[model samples]
Target: MVPVAALAAGAAIILSGCSAGQVSQTADQVAAINGNTAEAGSIALRNVHIVFPGSGTHTNTAGGQAALALSIINTGETVTDELTGVTTDLGTVKITPADGDKIEIAPSETIVVSTPSAGAETHTTGETVDTEAGTTEAAAIEITGLTQDITPGLTYNVSFNFKENGTVQVEVPVDAGIESPRHESELSKSTTGSAGGH
Candidate 1:
Protein backbone atom coordinates (compact mmCIF):
# COMPACT_ATOMS: atom_id res chain seq x y z
CA MET A 1 0.00 0.00 0.00
CA VAL A 2 1.14 3.57 -0.76
CA PRO A 3 0.27 6.89 0.69
CA VAL A 4 -2.27 8.85 -1.35
CA ALA A 5 0.07 11.81 -1.83
CA ALA A 6 2.96 9.59 -2.90
CA LEU A 7 0.79 7.57 -5.22
CA ALA A 8 -0.50 10.74 -6.86
CA ALA A 9 3.02 12.05 -7.36
CA GLY A 10 4.16 8.74 -8.77
CA ALA A 11 1.31 8.71 -11.21
CA ALA A 12 2.18 12.22 -12.36
CA ILE A 13 5.74 11.16 -13.00
CA ILE A 14 4.64 8.16 -15.02
CA LEU A 15 2.23 10.18 -17.09
CA SER A 16 4.77 12.90 -17.72
CA GLY A 17 7.29 10.27 -18.61
CA CYS A 18 5.07 9.29 -21.50
CA SER A 19 5.48 12.82 -22.79
CA ALA A 20 9.24 12.86 -22.58
CA GLY A 21 11.21 15.04 -25.03
CA GLN A 22 7.93 16.73 -25.82
CA VAL A 23 7.90 19.25 -23.02
CA SER A 24 9.94 22.40 -23.50
CA GLN A 25 11.07 20.96 -26.80
CA THR A 26 10.10 23.98 -28.81
CA ALA A 27 13.43 23.96 -30.63
CA ASP A 28 14.39 20.49 -31.78
CA GLN A 29 13.01 19.21 -35.11
CA VAL A 30 15.78 16.67 -35.47
CA ALA A 31 14.23 14.08 -33.14
CA ALA A 32 10.52 13.69 -33.82
CA ILE A 33 9.46 10.31 -32.62
CA ASN A 34 8.42 8.42 -29.58
CA GLY A 35 8.13 5.11 -31.40
CA ASN A 36 7.99 6.90 -34.79
CA THR A 37 5.36 9.43 -33.78
CA ALA A 38 5.75 12.97 -32.52
CA GLU A 39 3.61 16.08 -32.23
CA ALA A 40 3.37 19.66 -31.22
CA GLY A 41 0.15 21.36 -30.33
CA SER A 42 -2.42 19.80 -32.62
CA ILE A 43 -0.04 18.83 -35.39
CA ALA A 44 1.45 15.36 -35.42
CA LEU A 45 4.60 14.63 -37.38
CA ARG A 46 4.89 10.96 -38.44
CA ASN A 47 7.64 8.79 -39.91
CA VAL A 48 9.98 11.75 -39.64
CA HIS A 49 13.40 10.90 -40.94
CA ILE A 50 16.52 12.50 -42.41
CA VAL A 51 18.77 11.14 -45.14
CA PHE A 52 22.52 11.46 -45.56
CA PRO A 53 24.77 11.23 -48.61
CA GLY A 54 26.30 7.91 -49.61
CA SER A 55 26.98 5.93 -52.77
CA GLY A 56 24.37 5.66 -55.56
CA THR A 57 21.06 7.45 -55.03
CA HIS A 58 21.98 8.53 -51.49
CA THR A 59 25.34 9.98 -52.40
CA ASN A 60 25.40 13.46 -50.96
CA THR A 61 28.55 15.52 -50.75
CA ALA A 62 29.66 14.08 -47.42
CA GLY A 63 29.20 17.15 -45.26
CA GLY A 64 27.19 18.68 -48.04
CA GLN A 65 23.50 17.86 -48.17
CA ALA A 66 20.70 16.16 -46.29
CA ALA A 67 16.95 15.98 -46.56
CA LEU A 68 13.98 15.54 -44.24
CA ALA A 69 10.99 13.33 -45.10
CA LEU A 70 7.87 13.22 -43.00
CA SER A 71 4.09 13.61 -43.01
CA ILE A 72 2.34 16.44 -41.24
CA ILE A 73 -1.11 15.76 -39.83
CA ASN A 74 -3.50 18.07 -38.07
CA THR A 75 -5.42 16.37 -35.28
CA GLY A 76 -7.80 19.13 -34.37
CA GLU A 77 -11.16 19.17 -36.09
CA THR A 78 -11.23 22.94 -36.41
CA VAL A 79 -7.59 23.91 -36.11
CA THR A 80 -5.43 24.96 -39.04
CA ASP A 81 -1.78 25.92 -39.20
CA GLU A 82 0.95 26.69 -41.73
CA LEU A 83 4.45 25.31 -41.99
CA THR A 84 6.59 28.39 -42.35
CA GLY A 85 10.33 27.74 -41.95
CA VAL A 86 12.78 24.96 -41.05
CA THR A 87 16.19 25.17 -39.35
CA THR A 88 18.88 22.70 -38.40
CA ASP A 89 21.73 22.89 -35.95
CA LEU A 90 24.15 22.24 -38.80
CA GLY A 91 23.04 25.15 -41.01
CA THR A 92 20.44 27.61 -42.19
CA VAL A 93 16.89 26.56 -43.19
CA LYS A 94 14.49 27.81 -45.83
CA ILE A 95 10.97 26.59 -46.51
CA THR A 96 8.89 26.68 -49.65
CA PRO A 97 5.52 28.45 -49.82
CA ALA A 98 7.02 30.40 -46.88
CA ASP A 99 5.05 31.82 -43.98
CA GLY A 100 2.52 33.94 -45.75
CA ASP A 101 2.31 31.32 -48.48
CA LYS A 102 3.01 28.27 -46.37
CA ILE A 103 1.63 24.76 -46.57
CA GLU A 104 -1.59 24.62 -44.71
CA ILE A 105 -2.49 21.53 -42.63
CA ALA A 106 -6.22 21.27 -42.49
CA PRO A 107 -8.01 19.56 -39.63
CA SER A 108 -7.37 15.83 -39.61
CA GLU A 109 -5.56 16.09 -42.91
CA THR A 110 -2.02 14.88 -43.56
CA ILE A 111 0.31 16.62 -46.01
CA VAL A 112 3.31 14.91 -47.52
CA VAL A 113 6.16 16.56 -49.38
CA SER A 114 8.93 14.57 -51.09
CA THR A 115 11.24 16.36 -53.47
CA PRO A 116 14.88 16.68 -52.45
CA SER A 117 15.74 19.16 -55.17
CA ALA A 118 13.34 21.58 -53.60
CA GLY A 119 13.67 20.20 -50.08
CA ALA A 120 16.59 20.78 -47.69
CA GLU A 121 20.30 21.03 -48.41
CA THR A 122 23.40 20.88 -46.21
CA HIS A 123 26.43 22.72 -47.57
CA THR A 124 30.11 22.38 -46.80
CA THR A 125 32.94 24.66 -47.95
CA GLY A 126 32.43 23.39 -51.49
CA GLU A 127 32.82 25.69 -54.48
CA THR A 128 29.07 25.58 -54.99
CA VAL A 129 26.18 25.76 -52.53
CA ASP A 130 24.16 22.82 -53.77
CA THR A 131 22.93 19.66 -52.03
CA GLU A 132 23.43 16.19 -53.41
CA ALA A 133 20.30 14.69 -51.92
CA GLY A 134 17.32 16.83 -52.84
CA THR A 135 13.67 16.12 -52.07
CA THR A 136 11.01 18.40 -50.72
CA GLU A 137 7.30 18.96 -50.53
CA ALA A 138 4.91 21.35 -48.82
CA ALA A 139 7.32 24.15 -49.63
CA ALA A 140 10.76 22.57 -49.45
CA ILE A 141 13.47 24.34 -47.55
CA GLU A 142 17.16 24.14 -48.34
CA ILE A 143 19.71 24.13 -45.52
CA THR A 144 22.90 25.85 -46.44
CA GLY A 145 26.28 25.78 -44.60
CA LEU A 146 26.63 22.54 -42.71
CA THR A 147 28.88 22.68 -39.66
CA GLN A 148 28.50 19.07 -38.57
CA ASP A 149 28.89 15.59 -39.99
CA ILE A 150 25.89 13.74 -41.51
CA THR A 151 26.11 10.04 -40.97
CA PRO A 152 23.74 7.14 -40.57
CA GLY A 153 22.03 6.87 -37.16
CA LEU A 154 23.48 10.24 -36.29
CA THR A 155 20.91 12.49 -34.67
CA TYR A 156 20.57 16.26 -34.93
CA ASN A 157 18.12 18.96 -34.10
CA VAL A 158 15.91 20.77 -36.64
CA SER A 159 13.51 23.44 -35.66
CA PHE A 160 10.30 23.63 -37.66
CA ASN A 161 8.61 26.99 -37.70
CA PHE A 162 4.89 27.04 -37.95
CA LYS A 163 2.35 29.79 -38.02
CA GLU A 164 -0.10 29.85 -35.10
CA ASN A 165 2.08 27.33 -33.24
CA GLY A 166 5.47 29.01 -33.17
CA THR A 167 8.50 26.68 -33.46
CA VAL A 168 8.69 23.00 -32.60
CA GLN A 169 12.06 21.37 -32.63
CA VAL A 170 12.83 17.63 -32.60
CA GLU A 171 15.87 15.44 -32.94
CA VAL A 172 15.75 13.75 -36.37
CA PRO A 173 17.34 10.38 -36.96
CA VAL A 174 19.79 9.94 -39.84
CA ASP A 175 19.02 6.95 -42.06
CA ALA A 176 22.05 6.17 -44.20
CA GLY A 177 20.54 4.13 -47.01
CA ILE A 178 16.89 4.90 -46.54
CA GLU A 179 14.76 7.19 -48.68
CA SER A 180 11.05 7.54 -48.53
CA PRO A 181 9.32 5.90 -51.48
CA ARG A 182 7.52 9.12 -52.27
CA HIS A 183 10.69 11.17 -51.93
CA GLU A 184 12.63 9.04 -54.38
CA SER A 185 12.32 10.60 -57.83
CA GLU A 186 14.12 10.84 -61.16
CA LEU A 187 14.95 14.45 -60.31
CA SER A 188 17.18 13.17 -57.51
CA LYS A 189 19.35 11.30 -60.00
CA SER A 190 20.47 14.56 -61.56
CA THR A 191 22.50 17.35 -59.98
CA THR A 192 19.74 19.88 -59.60
CA GLY A 193 19.47 23.15 -57.67
CA SER A 194 23.05 24.04 -58.63
CA ALA A 195 21.71 27.57 -58.84
CA GLY A 196 21.77 27.41 -54.98
CA GLY A 197 18.30 26.01 -54.33
CA HIS A 198 19.72 22.56 -53.51
Candidate 2:
Protein backbone atom coordinates (compact mmCIF):
# COMPACT_ATOMS: atom_id res chain seq x y z
CA MET A 1 0.00 0.00 0.00
CA VAL A 2 1.17 3.58 -0.68
CA PRO A 3 2.12 5.83 2.22
CA VAL A 4 -0.31 8.62 3.17
CA ALA A 5 2.27 11.34 2.64
CA ALA A 6 3.16 10.04 -0.84
CA LEU A 7 -0.50 9.81 -1.81
CA ALA A 8 -1.17 13.38 -0.62
CA ALA A 9 1.90 14.67 -2.52
CA GLY A 10 0.81 12.91 -5.72
CA ALA A 11 -2.69 14.41 -5.49
CA ALA A 12 -1.23 17.89 -5.00
CA ILE A 13 1.07 17.49 -8.00
CA ILE A 14 -1.77 16.32 -10.21
CA LEU A 15 -3.99 19.24 -9.22
CA SER A 16 -1.25 21.79 -9.82
CA GLY A 17 -0.32 20.27 -13.18
CA CYS A 18 -3.87 20.65 -14.45
CA SER A 19 -3.35 24.38 -14.99
CA ALA A 20 0.19 23.99 -16.34
CA GLY A 21 0.92 23.92 -20.09
CA GLN A 22 -2.55 25.26 -20.85
CA VAL A 23 -3.62 28.62 -22.23
CA SER A 24 -5.84 30.74 -20.02
CA GLN A 25 -9.38 31.45 -21.17
CA THR A 26 -9.75 34.41 -18.85
CA ALA A 27 -10.62 37.86 -20.21
CA ASP A 28 -7.08 39.04 -19.58
CA GLN A 29 -5.61 36.35 -21.80
CA VAL A 30 -8.23 36.51 -24.57
CA ALA A 31 -10.46 39.33 -25.70
CA ALA A 32 -14.18 38.96 -25.19
CA ILE A 33 -15.53 39.72 -28.65
CA ASN A 34 -19.03 39.10 -29.89
CA GLY A 35 -18.14 38.87 -33.56
CA ASN A 36 -15.35 37.33 -35.59
CA THR A 37 -12.33 39.28 -36.75
CA ALA A 38 -9.94 38.90 -39.70
CA GLU A 39 -6.98 40.70 -41.21
CA ALA A 40 -6.02 41.60 -44.77
CA GLY A 41 -2.59 43.10 -45.00
CA SER A 42 -2.57 46.21 -42.87
CA ILE A 43 -6.35 46.37 -42.83
CA ALA A 44 -8.20 44.61 -40.06
CA LEU A 45 -11.89 43.71 -40.05
CA ARG A 46 -13.41 43.78 -36.58
CA ASN A 47 -16.81 42.64 -35.31
CA VAL A 48 -17.55 40.91 -38.57
CA HIS A 49 -21.07 39.52 -38.42
CA ILE A 50 -24.21 39.08 -40.49
CA VAL A 51 -27.58 40.42 -39.37
CA PHE A 52 -30.54 38.12 -39.20
CA PRO A 53 -33.04 38.94 -41.94
CA GLY A 54 -36.01 39.29 -39.64
CA SER A 55 -36.92 39.70 -36.01
CA GLY A 56 -38.26 36.18 -35.74
CA THR A 57 -36.29 33.06 -34.99
CA HIS A 58 -37.12 31.74 -38.44
CA THR A 59 -34.18 31.47 -40.73
CA ASN A 60 -33.77 33.71 -43.72
CA THR A 61 -34.90 31.76 -46.72
CA ALA A 62 -32.67 30.99 -49.67
CA GLY A 63 -32.40 33.82 -52.21
CA GLY A 64 -33.31 36.25 -49.41
CA GLN A 65 -31.26 39.22 -48.34
CA ALA A 66 -29.23 39.89 -45.20
CA ALA A 67 -26.99 42.63 -43.92
CA LEU A 68 -23.30 42.44 -43.08
CA ALA A 69 -21.82 44.72 -40.45
CA LEU A 70 -18.16 45.27 -39.63
CA SER A 71 -15.53 47.90 -39.11
CA ILE A 72 -12.53 48.20 -41.45
CA ILE A 73 -9.51 49.59 -39.70
CA ASN A 74 -6.35 50.62 -41.50
CA THR A 75 -3.42 50.22 -39.18
CA GLY A 76 -0.87 51.65 -41.60
CA GLU A 77 0.57 54.96 -40.53
CA THR A 78 0.53 56.44 -44.05
CA VAL A 79 -0.70 54.02 -46.66
CA THR A 80 -4.37 54.38 -47.65
CA ASP A 81 -6.53 51.49 -48.84
CA GLU A 82 -9.77 51.24 -50.76
CA LEU A 83 -12.39 48.56 -50.38
CA THR A 84 -13.11 47.72 -54.01
CA GLY A 85 -15.45 44.81 -53.70
CA VAL A 86 -16.83 42.06 -51.50
CA THR A 87 -18.12 38.65 -52.51
CA THR A 88 -19.39 35.48 -50.98
CA ASP A 89 -20.42 32.07 -52.21
CA LEU A 90 -23.67 32.44 -50.30
CA GLY A 91 -24.64 35.64 -52.11
CA THR A 92 -23.56 38.84 -53.80
CA VAL A 93 -22.45 41.74 -51.66
CA LYS A 94 -23.48 45.29 -52.40
CA ILE A 95 -21.51 48.01 -50.64
CA THR A 96 -22.79 51.54 -50.70
CA PRO A 97 -20.64 54.32 -49.37
CA ALA A 98 -22.03 57.60 -48.14
CA ASP A 99 -19.72 59.18 -50.68
CA GLY A 100 -17.42 58.07 -53.49
CA ASP A 101 -17.52 54.83 -55.45
CA LYS A 102 -15.24 52.86 -53.17
CA ILE A 103 -14.92 52.89 -49.42
CA GLU A 104 -11.61 54.47 -48.50
CA ILE A 105 -9.70 53.91 -45.31
CA ALA A 106 -7.01 56.42 -44.64
CA PRO A 107 -4.01 55.67 -42.53
CA SER A 108 -4.81 55.20 -38.85
CA GLU A 109 -8.49 55.55 -39.65
CA THR A 110 -11.54 53.33 -39.36
CA ILE A 111 -14.59 52.90 -41.57
CA VAL A 112 -17.72 51.45 -40.01
CA VAL A 113 -20.14 49.32 -42.01
CA SER A 114 -23.64 48.89 -40.66
CA THR A 115 -26.87 47.21 -41.64
CA PRO A 116 -29.42 49.08 -43.72
CA SER A 117 -32.49 50.42 -42.01
CA ALA A 118 -35.82 48.70 -42.36
CA GLY A 119 -37.62 49.12 -45.73
CA ALA A 120 -34.52 50.65 -47.22
CA GLU A 121 -32.28 49.11 -49.84
CA THR A 122 -28.58 49.87 -50.14
CA HIS A 123 -28.59 52.42 -47.38
CA THR A 124 -25.41 54.38 -46.59
CA THR A 125 -24.97 57.12 -44.04
CA GLY A 126 -21.92 58.73 -42.49
CA GLU A 127 -20.40 62.00 -41.38
CA THR A 128 -17.03 63.26 -42.59
CA VAL A 129 -14.66 63.29 -39.63
CA ASP A 130 -11.61 65.30 -40.50
CA THR A 131 -8.89 64.33 -38.09
CA GLU A 132 -5.17 64.95 -38.17
CA ALA A 133 -4.76 61.37 -39.28
CA GLY A 134 -7.39 61.48 -42.08
CA THR A 135 -11.07 61.35 -42.87
CA THR A 136 -13.24 58.43 -41.78
CA GLU A 137 -16.29 57.30 -43.73
CA ALA A 138 -19.14 55.01 -42.80
CA ALA A 139 -20.76 52.65 -45.29
CA ALA A 140 -23.55 50.11 -45.50
CA ILE A 141 -23.24 46.53 -46.70
CA GLU A 142 -25.95 44.17 -47.90
CA ILE A 143 -25.83 40.59 -49.14
CA THR A 144 -28.45 39.63 -51.68
CA GLY A 145 -29.47 36.46 -53.45
CA LEU A 146 -28.30 34.28 -50.62
CA THR A 147 -28.21 30.69 -51.87
CA GLN A 148 -28.46 29.21 -48.39
CA ASP A 149 -30.64 29.82 -45.41
CA ILE A 150 -29.13 32.15 -42.82
CA THR A 151 -29.93 31.25 -39.23
CA PRO A 152 -28.65 32.19 -35.84
CA GLY A 153 -25.65 30.24 -34.49
CA LEU A 154 -24.46 29.54 -38.03
CA THR A 155 -21.38 30.93 -39.74
CA TYR A 156 -21.01 31.96 -43.38
CA ASN A 157 -17.95 32.64 -45.46
CA VAL A 158 -17.53 36.13 -46.90
CA SER A 159 -14.60 37.66 -48.74
CA PHE A 160 -13.64 41.31 -48.70
CA ASN A 161 -11.41 42.67 -51.44
CA PHE A 162 -9.38 45.80 -51.19
CA LYS A 163 -7.55 47.64 -53.91
CA GLU A 164 -4.24 47.47 -52.06
CA ASN A 165 -4.83 44.93 -49.31
CA GLY A 166 -6.03 42.19 -51.69
CA THR A 167 -8.68 39.85 -50.30
CA VAL A 168 -9.48 38.29 -46.95
CA GLN A 169 -12.01 35.56 -46.39
CA VAL A 170 -13.81 35.60 -43.06
CA GLU A 171 -16.27 33.20 -41.58
CA VAL A 172 -18.90 35.43 -39.99
CA PRO A 173 -21.71 34.43 -37.63
CA VAL A 174 -25.21 35.76 -37.12
CA ASP A 175 -26.05 38.45 -34.60
CA ALA A 176 -25.43 37.48 -30.97
CA GLY A 177 -28.77 38.65 -29.60
CA ILE A 178 -30.75 35.79 -31.10
CA GLU A 179 -28.41 33.25 -29.55
CA SER A 180 -30.07 33.65 -26.15
CA PRO A 181 -32.83 31.23 -25.20
CA ARG A 182 -35.15 34.05 -24.22
CA HIS A 183 -34.63 35.82 -27.54
CA GLU A 184 -35.24 32.57 -29.35
CA SER A 185 -38.56 32.16 -27.60
CA GLU A 186 -39.55 35.72 -28.42
CA LEU A 187 -38.63 35.18 -32.02
CA SER A 188 -40.69 32.04 -32.17
CA LYS A 189 -43.79 33.88 -31.00
CA SER A 190 -43.29 36.74 -33.41
CA THR A 191 -42.65 34.35 -36.26
CA THR A 192 -45.82 32.47 -35.51
CA GLY A 193 -47.83 35.68 -35.36
CA SER A 194 -46.47 36.89 -38.67
CA ALA A 195 -47.16 33.59 -40.36
CA GLY A 196 -50.73 33.62 -39.10
CA GLY A 197 -51.22 37.15 -40.34
CA HIS A 198 -50.03 36.27 -43.83
Candidate 3:
Protein backbone atom coordinates (compact mmCIF):
# COMPACT_ATOMS: atom_id res chain seq x y z
CA MET A 1 0.00 0.00 0.00
CA VAL A 2 1.12 3.61 -0.73
CA PRO A 3 1.72 6.11 2.03
CA VAL A 4 -0.99 8.85 2.26
CA ALA A 5 1.44 11.52 3.62
CA ALA A 6 3.71 11.16 0.56
CA LEU A 7 0.79 11.80 -1.85
CA ALA A 8 -0.41 14.82 0.14
CA ALA A 9 3.08 16.38 0.13
CA GLY A 10 3.40 15.91 -3.65
CA ALA A 11 0.02 17.61 -4.23
CA ALA A 12 1.01 20.57 -2.09
CA ILE A 13 4.18 21.11 -4.13
CA ILE A 14 2.24 21.18 -7.42
CA LEU A 15 -0.28 23.72 -6.10
CA SER A 16 2.51 25.97 -4.84
CA GLY A 17 4.17 26.02 -8.26
CA CYS A 18 0.89 26.91 -9.97
CA SER A 19 0.28 29.82 -7.60
CA ALA A 20 3.70 31.29 -8.35
CA GLY A 21 3.05 31.19 -12.09
CA GLN A 22 -0.24 33.08 -11.65
CA VAL A 23 1.49 35.89 -9.76
CA SER A 24 4.14 36.28 -12.47
CA GLN A 25 1.48 36.53 -15.16
CA THR A 26 -0.30 39.31 -13.34
CA ALA A 27 2.91 41.37 -13.05
CA ASP A 28 3.53 41.06 -16.79
CA GLN A 29 0.05 42.37 -17.59
CA VAL A 30 0.59 45.49 -15.54
CA ALA A 31 3.93 46.22 -17.23
CA ALA A 32 2.27 45.95 -20.63
CA ILE A 33 -0.12 48.68 -19.62
CA ASN A 34 2.84 50.86 -18.69
CA GLY A 35 4.51 50.53 -22.11
CA ASN A 36 4.40 47.51 -24.43
CA THR A 37 0.78 46.40 -24.68
CA ALA A 38 -1.75 48.26 -26.83
CA GLU A 39 -4.75 47.55 -24.69
CA ALA A 40 -8.07 49.35 -24.99
CA GLY A 41 -8.10 53.03 -24.07
CA SER A 42 -4.60 53.54 -25.50
CA ILE A 43 -3.07 57.03 -25.86
CA ALA A 44 -3.42 59.18 -29.00
CA LEU A 45 -2.72 62.71 -30.20
CA ARG A 46 -5.55 65.19 -30.92
CA ASN A 47 -6.15 68.84 -31.74
CA VAL A 48 -2.53 69.40 -32.75
CA HIS A 49 -1.78 72.95 -33.89
CA ILE A 50 1.48 73.90 -35.59
CA VAL A 51 2.35 77.62 -35.55
CA PHE A 52 5.00 79.00 -37.85
CA PRO A 53 5.53 81.72 -40.48
CA GLY A 54 3.04 81.38 -43.34
CA SER A 55 1.34 78.06 -42.63
CA GLY A 56 4.41 75.74 -42.90
CA THR A 57 5.62 74.97 -46.44
CA HIS A 58 8.54 73.23 -48.16
CA THR A 59 10.01 73.24 -51.69
CA ASN A 60 12.90 71.57 -53.53
CA THR A 61 14.54 72.20 -56.92
CA ALA A 62 12.03 69.79 -58.44
CA GLY A 63 9.16 72.17 -57.41
CA GLY A 64 7.56 69.33 -55.51
CA GLN A 65 8.61 70.38 -51.99
CA ALA A 66 5.87 71.28 -49.52
CA ALA A 67 6.01 72.89 -46.07
CA LEU A 68 3.91 71.67 -43.13
CA ALA A 69 3.89 72.51 -39.42
CA LEU A 70 2.30 70.39 -36.71
CA SER A 71 0.48 71.07 -33.48
CA ILE A 72 -0.54 67.81 -31.79
CA ILE A 73 -2.40 67.35 -28.52
CA ASN A 74 -2.96 64.14 -26.61
CA THR A 75 -6.54 62.93 -26.92
CA GLY A 76 -6.71 59.54 -25.29
CA GLU A 77 -6.38 59.48 -21.50
CA THR A 78 -4.47 56.22 -21.48
CA VAL A 79 -2.27 56.86 -24.52
CA THR A 80 -1.33 60.30 -23.32
CA ASP A 81 -0.02 58.78 -20.16
CA GLU A 82 2.31 56.67 -22.24
CA LEU A 83 3.82 59.51 -24.25
CA THR A 84 7.35 58.36 -23.49
CA GLY A 85 6.72 55.43 -25.79
CA VAL A 86 5.03 57.39 -28.56
CA THR A 87 7.04 57.34 -31.81
CA THR A 88 6.43 59.71 -34.72
CA ASP A 89 6.25 58.27 -38.24
CA LEU A 90 7.81 61.35 -39.89
CA GLY A 91 11.54 61.03 -40.55
CA THR A 92 13.54 64.29 -40.05
CA VAL A 93 13.88 68.02 -40.86
CA LYS A 94 16.10 69.48 -43.58
CA ILE A 95 16.77 72.79 -45.49
CA THR A 96 15.95 75.33 -42.76
CA PRO A 97 16.54 78.98 -43.65
CA ALA A 98 19.74 80.67 -42.42
CA ASP A 99 17.84 82.21 -39.51
CA GLY A 100 16.68 79.50 -37.08
CA ASP A 101 13.21 78.86 -38.56
CA LYS A 102 11.45 76.56 -36.13
CA ILE A 103 9.63 77.12 -32.85
CA GLU A 104 7.03 75.28 -30.75
CA ILE A 105 4.24 77.18 -29.02
CA ALA A 106 2.09 76.31 -26.05
CA PRO A 107 -1.64 76.73 -25.56
CA SER A 108 -1.25 80.44 -24.83
CA GLU A 109 2.22 81.10 -26.20
CA THR A 110 3.73 81.41 -29.70
CA ILE A 111 7.10 81.32 -31.51
CA VAL A 112 8.17 82.12 -35.07
CA VAL A 113 10.61 80.65 -37.62
CA SER A 114 11.26 81.93 -41.15
CA THR A 115 12.47 80.65 -44.53
CA PRO A 116 13.02 82.69 -47.72
CA SER A 117 12.44 81.65 -51.30
CA ALA A 118 12.65 83.50 -54.66
CA GLY A 119 10.84 82.39 -57.81
CA ALA A 120 9.79 83.92 -61.13
CA GLU A 121 6.53 85.89 -61.47
CA THR A 122 4.39 84.98 -64.46
CA HIS A 123 2.27 87.49 -66.38
CA THR A 124 -1.14 86.84 -68.00
CA THR A 125 0.71 86.36 -71.34
CA GLY A 126 2.62 83.33 -69.98
CA GLU A 127 5.89 85.34 -69.93
CA THR A 128 8.30 85.65 -66.97
CA VAL A 129 7.95 89.25 -65.84
CA ASP A 130 10.26 89.53 -62.81
CA THR A 131 11.24 87.17 -59.99
CA GLU A 132 9.48 88.18 -56.81
CA ALA A 133 11.81 87.81 -53.83
CA GLY A 134 9.67 86.25 -51.15
CA THR A 135 9.42 83.10 -49.11
CA THR A 136 9.14 80.22 -51.53
CA GLU A 137 8.27 76.67 -50.47
CA ALA A 138 8.12 76.83 -46.68
CA ALA A 139 10.01 74.33 -44.46
CA ALA A 140 8.41 71.33 -42.82
CA ILE A 141 9.02 70.47 -39.15
CA GLU A 142 7.92 67.32 -37.33
CA ILE A 143 7.94 66.32 -33.66
CA THR A 144 9.50 63.13 -32.31
CA GLY A 145 10.54 61.64 -28.92
CA LEU A 146 7.14 62.13 -27.27
CA THR A 147 6.91 60.27 -23.94
CA GLN A 148 5.31 61.28 -20.70
CA ASP A 149 2.51 60.62 -18.24
CA ILE A 150 -0.33 62.72 -19.64
CA THR A 151 -3.18 64.07 -17.52
CA PRO A 152 -6.59 65.44 -18.48
CA GLY A 153 -7.35 69.12 -19.09
CA LEU A 154 -3.72 70.06 -19.60
CA THR A 155 -1.49 71.07 -22.51
CA TYR A 156 2.21 70.93 -23.39
CA ASN A 157 4.49 72.95 -25.67
CA VAL A 158 7.14 70.94 -27.48
CA SER A 159 9.87 72.02 -29.95
CA PHE A 160 11.26 70.12 -32.93
CA ASN A 161 14.89 70.80 -33.86
CA PHE A 162 15.69 70.00 -37.47
CA LYS A 163 18.87 68.52 -38.90
CA GLU A 164 20.11 68.63 -42.50
CA ASN A 165 18.66 65.16 -43.16
CA GLY A 166 19.11 63.26 -39.90
CA THR A 167 17.25 62.73 -36.65
CA VAL A 168 15.61 65.75 -35.05
CA GLN A 169 15.74 66.67 -31.40
CA VAL A 170 12.29 67.01 -29.86
CA GLU A 171 12.29 69.10 -26.73
CA VAL A 172 10.04 67.93 -23.93
CA PRO A 173 7.37 70.41 -22.93
CA VAL A 174 6.98 71.63 -19.36
CA ASP A 175 3.19 71.82 -19.33
CA ALA A 176 2.46 68.19 -20.26
CA GLY A 177 -0.02 66.30 -18.11
CA ILE A 178 0.36 62.82 -16.65
CA GLU A 179 -2.77 60.80 -16.06
CA SER A 180 -3.27 57.46 -14.30
CA PRO A 181 -5.07 54.58 -15.93
CA ARG A 182 -8.69 54.03 -14.87
CA HIS A 183 -9.62 50.64 -13.46
CA GLU A 184 -12.84 48.95 -14.55
CA SER A 185 -13.39 47.51 -11.07
CA GLU A 186 -14.17 50.97 -9.79
CA LEU A 187 -17.13 51.19 -12.13
CA SER A 188 -18.50 47.94 -10.86
CA LYS A 189 -18.30 49.17 -7.30
CA SER A 190 -20.11 52.39 -8.16
CA THR A 191 -22.87 50.46 -9.85
CA THR A 192 -23.25 48.22 -6.84
CA GLY A 193 -23.43 51.20 -4.52
CA SER A 194 -26.16 52.85 -6.57
CA ALA A 195 -28.21 49.66 -6.63
CA GLY A 196 -27.96 49.25 -2.86
CA GLY A 197 -29.02 52.85 -2.23
CA HIS A 198 -32.21 52.39 -4.22
- Give the Å shift of residue 153 in candidate 2: 1.3
Question: What does candidate 3's lDDT look like per residue over 1-198, in tens digits?
Answer: 378988988999988787476575665553211111111122222223222112223222122232223222222222112112112333223433212443212222111222222111111111122223211222233332223322324333432332211122232221111233555775465553464753
Per-model TM against the reference: 0.54, 0.70, 0.22
lDDT of 2: 0.75
Model 2 stretches with alpha carbons more than 4 Å out: 1-22, 27-29, 54-59, 116-124, 128-136, 178-198
Estimate the lDDT of model 3: 0.28
Give the range where candidate 3 is weakest over 10 consecutive residues by summed lDDT.
31-40
Tens digit per residue, CA lDDT, model 1, 1-198: 469989999999888776466564564565534214567888887766665443324333344555566667777778778887787777766455422456777676666543354223322211122223222234344555566666655567877777877788787776544354545677666565566454
Query: Each candidate: RMSD to true structure?
Result: 17.2, 8.5, 19.8
- In angstroms, the error of model 1 at 83 is 1.3
> Which candidate number would show the highest lDDT if scored against the true structure?
2
lDDT of 2 by residue, 1-198 (tens): 569989999999888776556543442464555479999999999988886555522235687777777888999987988999988887777888857777888889888787555222233576655666556566888877879888778898888999998999999988755335554565475553464753
Deviation of model 3 at 39, angstroms:
17
The segments of candidate 3 whose C-alpha lies over 4 angstroms from its true place after superposition are 21-23, 31-198
